[model samples]
Target: IVGIDAAIFMHPTTWKASGHVDNFNDPMIDNKDSKKRYRVDHLIEEYAAALSAEGKENEAAALLASMETLLAKDDFTGLKKMIDDNKMQCAVSHTCNWTEIRQFNLMFSTEFGTAVSSEEGNNIVYLRPETAQGIFVNFLNVQKTGRLKIPFGIAQIGKAFRNEIVARQFVFRMREFEQMEMQFFVRPGTQKEWYEKWKAKRMQWHESLGMPAAKYRFHDHVKLAHYADAACDIEYEFPIGFKELEGIHSRTDFDLQQHQQYSKKKMQYFDNDLNPETGKPYGNYIPYVIETSIGLDRMFLAVISQAYEEQDLSLPAGEAGTEEKKDSRVVLKLPPVLAPIKLAVLPLTKKDGLPAIAEEIIQACKPHFRCFYEEKDSIGKRYRRMDALGTPYCVTVDHQTKEDQT
Candidate 1:
């Protein structure tokens, strides 16, 4: 299927059709003294971790269990009580002066066009909070136009915005970020199989990066979302902790059905294949969707963290001198396909046709992949710089190349 780039701004009613208007919210609370707000789950998680750090293992576990229970029940009063009972304090206030937990909408809103008259109502617009909705709205159009068959996918990479109250951990959780999302359409009962397939495939893709296997684990969602029948996260062990790097969800026709209801449009597919049981064509039905959504910035941070290395080139303990004891280099050992710069052309010296040879090689190879040519620094220093930039290959031009054309 052709890739899609969804518009960042859609009709205001688009969100309402997608259920973001009524349900896409985070529970947040503020400190009365400092007026600092925090997402309820983040606050509770931080407090629970602190409890475990203080060696209160059982207490932390119980607190987390209760918090989850309260959250599932939507018992905001009990949630606030739990926070107050545990004496969770704000980072700024240092006191347990907390206000009641309230639901906060995460979508950022804006006005679209200027009104020409006083009678004109405000033309409110919203930045899309997720790319999946865009995919849902366009699924039928692409499926019929491209003649895509069942089990086909529509993938997109686009920016999304959220008014995150507790946006922290750098790019892990940001107000504005990009997402790479794919929604696979399939028969209603087959979504589970497809969901599992994508879970394994996505994990395999991450493992192929050659990072340690111990650093990744699948975290199945204990509480499914409003639209998801099954969901799980591909979590990577970042410096902060094992956070979600990608998500795989089985969304069972909720998105398409909602849009159909709101827009009065038929979002159904006509399957001509005969159903074995009834010996009749399965016709006119909404398809189940299996979605794999990867956070682009989070994946970038994860790759960078995994590729960075501090290598020790010092001699062996028994066989070497102490002069080279501290010899080391910092390198970004990125894979060739993913590295930003693929090749570096270095000249051994500024003269003797060496720099000219490097430039010739650069001209020959520049079209295929990114190339960097340098003669300002020593060869060793230039190599180090290329390593730091994560260039996977370095071609050094010297007098030997001029002699033998090697």
Candidate 2:
């Protein structure tokens, strides 16, 4: 478990250094009929889902691939044509008419100080669109203060704000969200090896959570950002369909280089390790970064989706009564380590000092893990309640427990 770090609320120049002021944007389109704006990618994804639901899996797959190709090329006209050809309609208006796609900035900006001036030059500061810039700006301070060497990493988890034109799909996309990000600094030209290493390691970490491997896939970016040399997203199958859960990016010294130029600060790291190729110590150079960024909310949604299950627990015909009915339950089968309630202490009855015994158990286990105490209902009902909460273990206190301490 990593510790939470303070968020960075910095000058607008910091955002300009990070390129967020200019490059952080999404392609957006509006439905002419409904006058509703939609992110182009979301619109295509919805259309793809409709196709998949109609038993046109091949068509849906092809449509998604085409959309990706168009986006990679930044072919906005081709994208509009694809939408028209597919006859995709706006969900709200049920019409196919659409305006030309345009770029929409995602960063939230505000005036830095109370001023009567309407000028934006010195007054405007932006809520950081991402958390990595905070790490980048403080790289030297951390390296020098910690007496660090090359190949070290800095990790952070903090809130990021975005002015999303179309924020939907529950918490998957939000104006305010949390990001768990780590930036690993490595010597120049070693970035490729480290990138591959992190890609595999991150995938393994997800699998270690006991999630099905088939439920996750890596989507390589066809169109990389200005700062990225290599990048891919770990996509998970959510209730809304497959979507990006985390991103691994090979940012080749771009961030540090930009900060160096903008801040006029030295961002280079000196390496003492001998380079096998040159048979000499590697000299000072800006470290290339491998960034692993995950959306905490998206990860939570993925976990909950996998854990939720609907089960039928009806008895066999011979063991059932004449008026027997089918019984069903909705359960969250979360992993034991991830479950909110690890243990539940339920007394069979609230009387006869049973509640006291349960409370004792709660006090003991609460220090070790999360525990829930419930004694108001029947043992069977309490067990079901624990099941709904995804509690892995339940202990019952009864009359026999008072005698044998079992």
Instruction: Give the best candidate by lDDT.
Output: 1
List the global CA lDDT of all models: 0.89, 0.88
Worst ten-residue run, lDDT, model 1?
A: 113-122
Which portions of model 2 show Cα errors greater than 4 Å? 1-6, 310-330, 351-364, 402-405
User: lDDT at 405 for candidate 2?
Assistant: 92
For 262-375, candidate 1 gives per-residue lDDT tens digits of 999999999998989899998879999999999999999998888899888887756576444557898998978789999899889999999888888999998998888889
Q: For all candidates, what are the clash counts?
A: 0, 0
List model 2 lDDT by residue over 30-140, tens digit each.
Answer: 998899999998899888888889999998899889898999898999998988888889988999999999989998877766766666467877888888998888888
Candidate 2 deviation (Cα RMSD): 3.0
**Candidate 1 all-Cα RMSD:** 3.6
Per-candidate TM-score against the hidden true structure: 0.90, 0.90
